[model samples]
Target chain A: MKNNTKIRKSHGSGGQQSHDLLENVFIPHFRNSYLSDLEDSAVLEGWNGNIAFTTDSYVVDPLQFPGGDIGKLAVSGTINDLAVRGAKPLYLTAGFILEEGLEISVLDNIVRSMAETSKQSGVKIVAGDTKVVSRGSADKLFINTAGIGSVPENLKLGAKYIEPGDEIIINGNIGDHGLAVLLAREDFGLITDIESDVNPLSSLIRKVLDADVKLHAMRDPTRGGLASTLNEIAQLRSVDMYIDEDHIPISDTVESVCQLLGLDPFSIANEGKALFFVAPDDCGRLLQILGSQPLGVHAARIGTVRAGNGQVVLNTRIGGNRLIDMPLGELLPRIC
Target chain B: MKAEIQKIVDEIHTECGEEPIRLMEVCGTHTMAIHRYGLRSMLPSNLQLVSGPGCPVCVTPIHFIDAVLQLATRDDTVICTFGDLIRVPGSSASLESEKMNGHQVRVVYSPVDALRMAIRDKHLHYIFIGVGFETTAPAVAAVIEMARENKVTNFSVACAHKTMPEALKRLAADRQIQIQGLICPGHVSAIIGIQAYEWLAKHHNIACVVSGFDPGDILVSVLMLCRQIKRNECVAGIQYDRVVKAIGNTKALALMHRVFEPCDSEWRGLGMIPASGLAIKSGFRRFDALYRFPVKVKKSPTPSGCICGDILKGIKTPLQCGLFAKECRPDSPIGACMVSSEGTCAAFFKYQVVKSCA
Candidate 1:
């Protein structure tokens, strides 16, 4: 392994030398299950049914952005991962890698934000871990979270079950998360009030699952956004996909930011949105179920699976068609 | 919009006779747009589309990559670069691969990140890999201005910056290349203005159209260029009128002029072109790495039989390269053209160019 010592020192005070800024911020806010108070592990009660587990690391620079912070990001990111996997998140285990010399107050604020987000997400922080390095070792803060949730019975969802003729649906707009972070960095001087839609999708997924909707596959559009997610789905099912660009939901603010940055919103990242591969007959019901939720107001039936050799084609609003390929490399790096 | 675009394509198909006319889009975004829109399928075999050296990262020489690798290898040096340049392979390896070998390579969204790195590391030297056209050069120049104002001595930029008009002129002048028309970059045009392209039309007698990244914009630009070729007229046309203006962004241009002065810069394929690269003005020379480090590194030659130079000039296609696909894939790129997503070879490889034989 490379020497972590030199890397640790560069993270100065303004840099916030905390590895898990989320834990440092949230532990004090939620006194009920402040895992920081405990020494080793968080004690939790066993669940009765099938459980879902997911882990994610957040390293978005300018830790705090338009809509959320690293604390909220860590919670929402992990929650969304399990939520799309058809799980009702019950607990989250947060691990923080703090760089030395991080301000105690910023850590408090991050923890506080995490507590509020956990409350909003309806999940408790039951267990957590923390490690400190000399400043330069990590970014101001890096959050790693593992979450567990109870899976409902008779709910079978995965790419393997996806079949031809299924409709692909996106919960809302894409690229808000990526654009929000980009704007927050103030790198380009282009400014907008667009905040990251970094909220947990568990509640929305729960609504859909409760409606008894049949989902062949469900994935959160995170790092690589909608393009990569759909490409993965198409490749996994050995089927082709046809999406209409006009039908896809995109905020005007998001579109403007993308234009300014010379970035494609389809390829940008999103934390609050999920793409679902549902049976054609079940799409209407799923849309209705999704529409009932606050996060699913912009839900859309963007595309359908076709008979082909696993290609993803996007039909533009102007009647031209283009292939949406998987993102080759890092577009927005360290984004959850 | 689809009907209009299709109608234009049909008209071009009918106008161009049995002999095909080759049109090269010199913008990276245009290449990506053509590939993404599957525009290749819509165009008649009579019209051929090729990608040019509009991609700054793609045209950046291997020596620059090696220089960056050298900088990254230094414990006190933090090499900051745009996201696209990270994966571009040099002679030995790419910065991404070098990062795996314990190099301090960080993919930054903006030059400000490099400035921030410099501020964070007081003792270490922070060198921002300054790369791109006029669209990006202004922001980098601004960062340099900011560093100078703040008296941040640790910060310096390794400028591999290039200008578009000169490169286009050089390509058109090369007798080996037969570029009939040019699809200029919308982003770069928006910064430098359409007025800058008059040289291409005036000197090279080539049809130039500033096009947008959108599929509709590209289709319209192609139609415009075909009309110019048919009318035997050479002029700069604007298809991306939504954002790009004839005069361009004056404020951005002023900012660029304030900090950077035009210099003879070397391109990976086209060699040294006059007034092609941007160097920090004498007043801002403190932020330049060349002035600070004073290293006399020998310029390395392109990989043998790479043919990237010829391909960049639009004289040959990626298929002409012996290593293309067989030995030089995106994962193991042997040339700068294959390494960058915007490079002609990379575009051809990514889109799987369908060669047409007479």
Candidate 2:
């Protein structure tokens, strides 16, 4: 009703147009035997276990960015949430709020991205609903993903398992995803080729779980980067965290941007990375194992946990110590 | 380079003889760099590095913030400010809290963004809370020129701009702080030139060394200061020669001079100092928020449990403050020095992260 492929209000009116969009676009892209039924609720044919259910919304301003898009982000974010809880991701339900007058090509690209990501991650988009709001009432598009994953009876990972002498490990470099997104915004005249490190980390987590190393606590540093994640772990586990500035791996490009912008690389968010709290002896083995993989080539043991209430300290390269405080206000709004 | 710095520090430690050397770093970045690199641990027990009132946010009086918060509440006004200023507390509330209360306060990375925002919303009064030293002033002045050229009537600046030379001069005159040498500001030197420290060097007989915001640069500058003091040579030295010139950025000076003139200004800890603050000149008076808005700033009151005044004046360290770490923290800062990233208390809390009593 709008352009050749532009979206309109009627498309979300729960009429013939909505049916046509589902049958033509959503159905063909995310087609599976279970998804083809087009029922109100998705019935996973034979799924029963301790299911880990989580939901996250994506509304990044520049919907498309280098290394990933809003679609990929929506999938990756929810997938990582499940993966961190020691679960093998199973199915995802995507709900979209489309702004009227959006180009069908843009929606097409987002949908295609979602479908590709889902297929690659071995998850089926079993159900979805779309709603179109009037122009100015909504941004270009907003995607909400609700995912459910299954956890084995023996597989248990959380703060309760963490000990004082455990080691803090990261998959890759810090501050890449947040910095890449910022550079992609093209604000402040900063230009960098840094791409968003947004990826579904389920495969790598599974590989690590398959290994002999004991992962006490596992989490993805999504919103607040390494600092926030460590702070949360410390608060939950009733311990102190001390990381050496020299040990924390940071790229030269990311460091330069942080220097220019007065932003801390540790405090910046990471989309594709995960933090693992492992025993001191197992830290070396875990690092070697994670480093061998493509998703975690730069894995390193960054810090050590100590017996304290709740504090994260950074042992400075110059030989002093500083507290890594939880960022109070929004470091970068709409970052996730 | 690290070993060479260690050697220099050793030589300076030996050169100190009996009395300890108290050198003050006047820039906030230098304070941060020293802590970030853990330079304090590397320094000799005889040499003590202190913080001066160089941080613009740390030294900005409470009334200025109260005035800005008042302006933010107005229906027809929009407040444009740098990110850090939003968190700095006034008497009752801050711009960050006001924003959460549905005020139109925008955090801009650069002053140009605020100017552009002002031009875009012509119907609304846009007040940019200008807070910085000479390094940022020239850039803000350049954008003011653009605003004037385009005749952006809505744009005005609540200027809290200050100069480093006057503040440094006042510190040299103060006796209690015990400053034997000086580590000058790198970014401010890039604007006002290395020659700006000549007066303090000649009159006060203090060895002033300009430094870049890096561990090596700061160490090299400290070593230079130590050697100068050892040799009894009170002069201005430039160690950050790559970015800062001997004479300084002349074109930037011209732009700054064209937009602002010297006036008596009130520093947070230091009382009213003459010719320290900059006011928009008559040519650019139209962009002055002081003239446009009837700013009723309350009588500035010292923060209840903060000794940031003495901390900025080099008389007291963050550890010396009663409320530090216990009550005054980054999340709920009791003073301006704890709010800004580069402030002395913030640098101490962030890098030291230790209980003073312990």
Candidate 3:
């Protein structure tokens, strides 16, 4: 099995020296049972249970931005996806596609970030793979992660169960991640203090799921933002959502940046936030539970689900209403 | 808030009844706000609010688009533009369609992106399609400053920018279009100041109200314009008092004057308005694309059966076009006015104005 692991790591390495380092250092450092003999796979033997599986890719431009890097991005993205499904993340498998001639120091920093983030999220990085392509073939580095979690027996979470009159709540302000990336890119030469809230949410989610409140469905507003995610829920449940624009939590810096760029914060991407659809009776308790945690410090109830034919509308601050249509195309392409 | 706006609308209707008053909002932002907020539905049927050629993309001439397209097709040239200008159709094709044909065209959020690209790619020549009004013109001018300071000779700009007050004067002078008042743009007013439109108000007897992009702002501006028209008063009124000041941003205007000088510019519909466009001054002419490339473009005629010219002049609507929504959908635009989201035709098409009117 050790020899097989070597072969698999070499094959996944695609001729990069980092694969050799991972196999030599990281693999040998971990216990033998955690080491998988298969390529990009981890084997475990324990009590049987239903497993929650989720995968995500990080392709944020510049590879680095204010407050986080792609390594932190990969871990948080997958963990959040698993947490919203009412699962407790146990392990994560990371796959790296490194561009040829990339700096070894940059790769080392990214790997270190992944390790730190895994520790913070209380998950073990049991298996990983690396591949290198020709220079310019890949944009710096791309990280793909697959996570496995154990779902609690009593937890029932899905869009199908979302009922009318349910309350919609968000963990924190939207557009922080998008604005941080934009400010770091300096694409418009504007300066702001907004930073990406790219953090692991497994601990926070575990706390929320452990509470007595009933959560019908939970999703992190990532790529297409709060508006697009709400639209997805609306369509899935065949219901309508009415969100108050003024009630949505947006920082002053984010608001100013969006105003200047002609962007809607609701449509901007967010990384370290979750949207919870809870029973109307449980909203106050859920808010109390979330507010107790650091991750959900800015949590607020933004809207409610109404009986309609699957559409999302916003009651704007100006006392007028506008449809929050599905995003036509990538609002900010290459943003994780 | 709804009742307050409704009351203002009622006052406007009472004042403008039985009069065929055509009020035009000469700002792309205003055009978007009107459609996005459904403000057209609140106005009286007889009081027509037409969209003017305030959209820089809609008014940019075909020769400018052709020149950018030509540059984009080059082996070592890349064209950078704002998102709105990519799909605007020129005489033959748009920059977006040209890009699909293997040309290098990038959509940038700002002019600084073009400057950054020029600095990053030493081999490729970068030509920024400078197409906007005063609000954007200053930013492009700032890019020129950065390029010069960094000694980045690979970057040049194809300036197709126009001024607002000059176009407003042209629209007012034209007897064919009966425009009673104007809703001026808040952003442009923030740069050029409210004093820029003094001539238009004094001679044309047109009330100009600088308005914001909110529903309440538009409603209040409309009421102000109606009040002025009813009393035979002509002046520049400002409703967006928060962001727009009387003198405007002097620092931005100073940077603009340092890099560019006013020249006679050709509009797509309104042709050859004097001192309407900005050109790189003699000292800054090294960054001018026209001087560097020296390409002679054969003036192509506007597409037949397309009334974009009249539509932009506020003399016609998108419904007047035979191919407004049938052929000029947002995905497949046939003219500049339908290509940009802020364009009159695009704002109408996106909001399904035709169906709403029916």
- The weakest ten consecutive residues by lDDT in model 1 chain B span B349-358
Docking quality band of candidate 3, CAPRI definitions:
incorrect
Tens-digit lDDT string for candidate 1 (B1-358) = 7678778778767666666677888888788778756687677777888777888987887777777777777777778888678878766667888789887887777888889888887988888989999989999989998998999999999988899988887888877777778888999999999876788888888889999887878878888888888887989999999999999999999999999999998888888899998988999888888787765446787778788887877778888788998888876788878877777777766555323211
TM-score of chain A of each: 0.89, 0.97, 0.91
- Please give the TM-score for the first chain of candidate 1: 0.89
Positional deviation of residue A86's Cα in model 3 after best superposition, in angstroms? 2.2
Which candidate ranks first by lDDT, i.e. highest? 2
Clashes of 2: 2
Model 1: residue B316 alpha-carbon error in angstroms:
4.0
| Tens digit per residue, CA lDDT, model 2, B99-215 | 999999998888888888877778898888899999899988998899999989998898999998888889999888778899999999988887768888899999998898877
- Per-candidate TM-scores read 0.77, 0.89, 0.82
lDDT (Cα, 0-100) at B136 in candidate 2: 92
Off by over 4 Å in 1: A1-49, A57-63, A96-108, A130-143, B1-4, B64-176, B184-206, B210-214, B231-266, B271-294, B318-333, B339-341, B346-358
Highest-scoring model, DockQ: 2
Q: Per-model C-alpha lDDT, please?
A: 0.80, 0.86, 0.82
* Candidate numbers, best TM-score first, in rank order: 2, 3, 1
Interface RMSD of each: 5.1, 4.0, 4.3
Residue A223 of model 2 has an lDDT of 88
- Give the lowest summed-lDDT range of ten residues in model 2 chain A: A314-323
